[model samples]
Target: MNKAPLITKMLPRKNSLRNGGELDTKQLLAALMAFRRGDFSARLPEDWTGVAGKIADTFNDVIRTNQRMTQELGRIVRVVGKEGRITQRAALSDVSESWGDAIGCINVLIEDLLRPTSEMARVIGAVAKGNLSETMASEIEGQPLKGEFLRTAKTVN
Candidate 1:
């Protein structure tokens, strides 16, 4: 019942070129989704398990930082300016910038999380090259964030 070899063998018969030569982005996205949601715990690949754990840790840290930013922005919002007027514009701008910084931080974390995974890039590149069919594209497009990244990539191309 060594499923790894069994699965590997079956994939080639399924789509030799697409599976072996260039992985479908849909498959990769599915894998990533499962990994993130802890759905693939039983059959987690060794390499991916290590990377995913680190990514999860970083994700938690980023979320905590975002919470702190929100609290600080809330305090700023409560401040009043001269003539007893609430500094609405300044407060709004500060809140916006704080949220933007949180977004930037999350984006940086994403880059770090993905930078070590050449496999992800390769799969996405395959999708970019039109190797995946419409059904596969749809599945990947349904994945959160994956769709937006793919759309942005398409726009750039």
Candidate 2:
């Protein structure tokens, strides 16, 4: 029996399959869902890699801003002003509120940065855990929790 060609019989591919540029939301969402299920390289748009770094940088900035605000609030709390520190306390509270807002901003930025990569990394890392060699595991276990990885040791002698 002469059947229609196999290619003709097959269903049409999605838009991403036909197009050759940035993946749309559906594709990204599918990839994210796939990432949740198992390991898969979450392909990013060429511009995405750059954008991720920027988001991380912004997150860092927010953290720094929070720290600075906290320190400034502490200083304000210590000040001996003629208004009996009420004004200073109020100002410090405002700064603390601002710090809270900054933290929220950082949360949003982190979510943006993590959109797909976090899931991808989680899936990949989980897969890696299952496939780790004893030697690699030993190396990781043995590696000093110091040097570049330890923030507390920033001023190591």
Candidate 3:
């Protein structure tokens, strides 16, 4: 089978815009196309003025934030795999509203994941010393532990 080139697939049917006030879309298109190809470094020209410039800057910021998150995730994997601890956290600044929520969610997930492991370790240490009575306390006021942690705590007790 034969296939068209990737860049050709991204090109518009016509080169010129009919409206005079239309912003030159080539840079934005190219950046988006590069991003679709997994190039997180792709960025539109910030030198563009007015709405175009704002759009480009926002796009760039999103790409940079994603890149930072990716890097931080890698670091988290390495640290947790080697040191068995999530000693570092991802910090995303000046991101769009959606990205802010996503970052917050990721942080919360990491903390939730670590909490069970730490609690289990504490319980297991006590068990190792023949103190089988040690169990995870449902001490978080309104929030009682659920899921696997709760099951493990029951088994341990």
Candidate 4:
């Protein structure tokens, strides 16, 4: 009367570590290839017990961390570079290792980029206010102006 159980019992066990049902490795290979193609959204199953499972866990962790960093970087760049909101900084507070170094360098670079702009604004603003005595330094933070920036600084000063 009921053939459901009979048909189900006819199939082989799947790789429980991944799909947990079908033993076919096509899914695994496809997921791996997707990861190789710059897709970090797919995560391998962590159900395996041996070395493979451990490797999968490490891979997922790395992907998660890198994804977060990349997202934060995109947000920071959009806000600061595209929107002209230079005060915005990367919100990754608990970062460490090379990631931390990268974030720190980017923040420092923002400040450096702002310095000349701020100096110009101050000089120009003072001039607009009729003070007529505002002058821009030849260099900011020991870095001399060059090319167009130097020319603009001279003109503004």
Candidate 5:
């Protein structure tokens, strides 16, 4: 079996490479390989028109969105780690719609974690002023605080 025929059939014609309207397969392959190696900066030439241009644009958009998400997540981790609480909520304006659930979950986690701590601080402050009857404001009927937080509130009370 002559492998030359099979190899020739798999490759684009030489004329196709020089065609001004066609995508440069070599460049596209390099960009894709770079992306696969975790280099999000790789991008196909935007000058290529038609579907090729659209595909490149879409890939670039995905890379940019992913980079933004990674940076934002790092910022969140640093803020929470250094300050011991989430100071600012993650910005959702530029984030993709697929991340909406994750953003909402993070916000909820921040609120849940801080709410009990804030209530404890307030109760402790009130007690420190000789008002021993003070208790956590979160000790309501339907929205009772949970587990360790409830026990903390009881101890403070």
Candidate 6:
């Protein structure tokens, strides 16, 4: 009977439904909303084959790349700033465009910060060894010392 077809349709398909991860409009909206709220965990279902699936795959790739970079930068910040490890550098595998520029800037900042300390130590150590001819350079990394550092450098010189 035709009624039988309707009843059969009411029965769940054999492993066809995607549970809560279907790539419907509702799922897409939910994923977008989650991403807007800074949650990158909600990803579209890429298993569905079609243009929608390809788009989902691309979107998921972007999210994964962003998450990876954010976590890596945060780790570097924690290690260098909180842990006082100025030697720590962001190890970016996919350094492209501004991503590479940002990582390079951070590494350069760390180097710039460490340079003065290193120069001061070297000059002071030389002075301690009775080599007064060795004086703290007027500038480090092309940036002249300021405030207390400048005063100390002048006194040491």
Best by lDDT: 6
lDDT of 3 by residue, 1-157 (tens): 3557876775444543333223467767888989888799898876765656667788998788778878876777677656776756556766668877777887777787777777778989998999978887754335677877677767766
Q: Write the per-residue lDDT of candidate 1 for residues 1-157, one digit (tens) a residue.
A: 6789877775534323431243343555665576466443312222333434444445444444445555544553454223322322222233456576665664454443343233345656776888663221212324433554556445433
Considering TM-score, which of the candidate structures 4 and 6 is the better prediction for this target? 4
Off by over 4 Å in 2: 1-49, 80-86, 89-157
- The ten-residue window of minimal lDDT in model 6 covers 14-23
The 10-residue segment of model 2 with minimum total lDDT is 132-141
lDDT of 2 by residue, 40-82 (tens): 3444343433434343344444444545665654564465233
| Per-residue lDDT of candidate 6, residues 1-157 (tens digit) | 3699888776435423344333466677888898888798979886855555766888887788778888988998799889988778987786599888888988887887778778888988998898989988878868888887788778878
Ranking by TM-score: 4, 3, 6, 5, 2, 1
What TM-score does model 6 achieve against the real structure? Answer: 0.65
Residue 124 lDDT, candidate 6, scale 0-100: 89
Off by over 4 Å in 4: 1-33
Lowest lDDT block of 10, candidate 3: 13-22
Candidates' C-alpha lDDT: 0.44, 0.42, 0.72, 0.78, 0.74, 0.78
Q: List the residue pairs that clash in candidate 6.
A: none
Error of 6 at 146 (Å): 5.5
Candidate 5 wrongly placed segments (more than 4 Å)? 1-38, 84-87, 137-142
- Preferred candidate (TM-score higher): 5 or 6: 6
| TM-score comparison, 3 vs 6, better candidate | 3
lDDT, residue 28, model 3: 74
What stretches of model 1 exceed 4 Å from their correct place? 1-49, 81-157
Among residues 3 or more apart in sequence or in different chains, the pairs in candidate 5 whose N, CA or C atoms overlap within 3 Å are none
Number of backbone collisions per candidate, in order? 0, 0, 0, 3, 0, 0
Q: What tens-digit string does per-residue lDDT give for candidate 5 at 8-106?
A: 886657525333446677787898888788787888777876655666688788777767777777778778756776567766566656787778888
Candidate 3: clashing residue pairs, number: 0
TM-score to true structure, per model: 0.24, 0.24, 0.66, 0.71, 0.64, 0.65
Q: Give the winner by TM-score: 2 or 5.
A: 5
Error of 2 at 101 (Å): 7.2
- When summed lDDT is taken over every stretch of 10 residues in candidate 1, the lowest stretch is 84-93
